[model samples]
Target: MRIIFSLFLVLSVSTIFSQEIETVQDSAIVKVDSLYREDQFYLGLTYNTLQQKPQGVSQNKFSVGLSAGFLRDMPINKDRTHAIATGLGFTFNNYVQNLAITGTGEMPFYTVLDDKTVFNKNKFTQLLVDLPIEFRWRTSTYESYKFWRIYGGVKFSYVLYNRSLYTDDQSKVVITNNIDFNKLLYGIYLSAGYNTVNVYAYYGLNPIFKSAEVGGENIKMKAFNVGIIFYVL
Candidate 1:
């Protein structure tokens, strides 16, 4: 009887000891995974509009912009929810407006078409390399995939290729790599939302044209964009 009681007591203590060991291992695993990062890759599509437009200038059709890039997320806090990110990206912007580009050489004449002027297409396109730096804040955890986040940043873009096309029943004018455009573009942008989809906006800090003029007025148009952005692991 005494031997049987001793064996039962030993078994109970062993079971409790094993359970404590397992709990410690599980806690260690969670601690290691808490140092996770987010928003390494992103793709965005935006509706583009012109701000500070010259008199009589108006957009004709849908002006769209597409962007894709990778960002390096660096956490700044112990919880890993506050971070700073910087990355390199590419952007393609198409602006469809009534700004007519005529003549050639070092300078191109700019004219804003009136309602009486009939045209099939009048648009300008830009392909740019983008450098983005952002400050990010989020309510995220290692186990949670859906969380709220807000990211605001400044983006610097360099135009690698540009084109201006105007066509009508009377004539067609095509300009490529014109020096009139500002090659270096900088802007402020903000993105905020939950989970994968975010609302995004960008406002250009400088004019689109360097020193171009339309009817004795400086072409001071800047870019304003609003759209959706997605982030991937």
Candidate 2:
């Protein structure tokens, strides 16, 4: 009877010890997983256009944009579903339009080319350094690699380099770093979707050029962009 009682006690203690060790291991795993983050790096491609264009100005060819960046995500809640992110990025933008810039100085000539005017190429390109601040919300967890997300933000850009080129049968005109362009630009943007693909849009709050005139008309054209963006861990 004594031997049986001792064996039963030993078995009970061993079972309790095993359960305690498992509980500690599970707790450690949960604590580590709760600190996971999402969408640290991003790449995007956009179709670029002009908004609030002058009466006769129109886009020509394909105006394209490319952007890439990394974001530092800071979770505001315990679940980490909501976050605020800020990052630095670079953008390359090309605007092919009927507007012609003819000179390379502080006071350059601006013209809105009519459809009858034939030109081989007329476009302006910009390289900008972008700073983005955004609010992020996602249905994401450590175990779920795919989820839905919505991110909205305002971006500030500083133009690093700019060029305008026009070519035709008669002559070729090129302008570099024209002072009329707004060196500092700001815009609002939004992105939303699931998994790896998201739709993105941006609307510039200010004009692309400052004190730029076309036929005695003040040029107040803003930029508009729409495209797809991808996020990666």
Candidate 3:
């Protein structure tokens, strides 16, 4: 009788242990199915348009820009439906406006109001470090990465490198000096969509140049960007 009782006790403990292991596995699966994940890598490209161009300047309204960066999406709610997002990125802005950036390395540079015929490619491209902060809402789950989402926030950028490219039938010239661009830019943006494709819009809160003086008249130029935003990771 002692042997039989000992055997029965051992079986009972083994069964309890097996049951507990199965329970834990089941709970883990449930949590995985309910949890939502965020993609931290972002790639953006947009049609860029220069707004409020200095008077007497004409440009092709259809210019484009590209951006890439990483973002941190922090959950603001227990359910993971709301988040505050921020990231660091870089952007390129190109414009075909008929403004020539001319400056001698030793002197102050200025945007000379001129004709496109004078310079083969009279476009200014902006290379900047972009910082974006947004409030996000989404319907997402671990099992389904596809869902509707809306993100509204502001982005600020600091120009790390800037230059003007002017090409002609004979030669291409790059101007680095005497170009007076606002080193810093701040703007508001919004992104909304489902899955990998999203619509985005940005409006600048600052002028594109520190100062634009043509014919002694002060001019202010701003940026307006519209495009698509993509998440990589």
Q: lDDT per prediction?
A: 0.94, 0.93, 0.79
> What does candidate 3 score on TM?
0.79
RMSD of each: 4.0, 4.5, 5.2
TM-score for each candidate, following the candidate numbering: 0.86, 0.86, 0.79
What C-alpha lDDT does candidate 1 achieve relative to the native structure?
0.94
Which runs in model 1 stand beyond 4 Å of their true positions? 1-32
Count clashes in each candidate, considering only residues at least 3 apart in sequence or on different chains: 0, 0, 3
The model with the greater TM-score, 2 or 3, is 2
Clashing pairs in model 2, backbone N/Cα/C closer than 3 A: none
Deviating ranges (above 4 Å) for candidate 3: 1-35, 105-118, 170-172, 177-179
lDDT of 3: 0.79
What is candidate 1's CA lDDT for residue 27? 82
lDDT measured at residue 215 in model 3 versus the true structure, 0 to 100: 61
Which candidate model has the greater lDDT, 2 or 3?
2
Q: Model 1 over residues 118-176: C-alpha lDDT tens digits?
A: 88999999999999999999999888889999999999999999899999998989998
TM-score of 2: 0.86
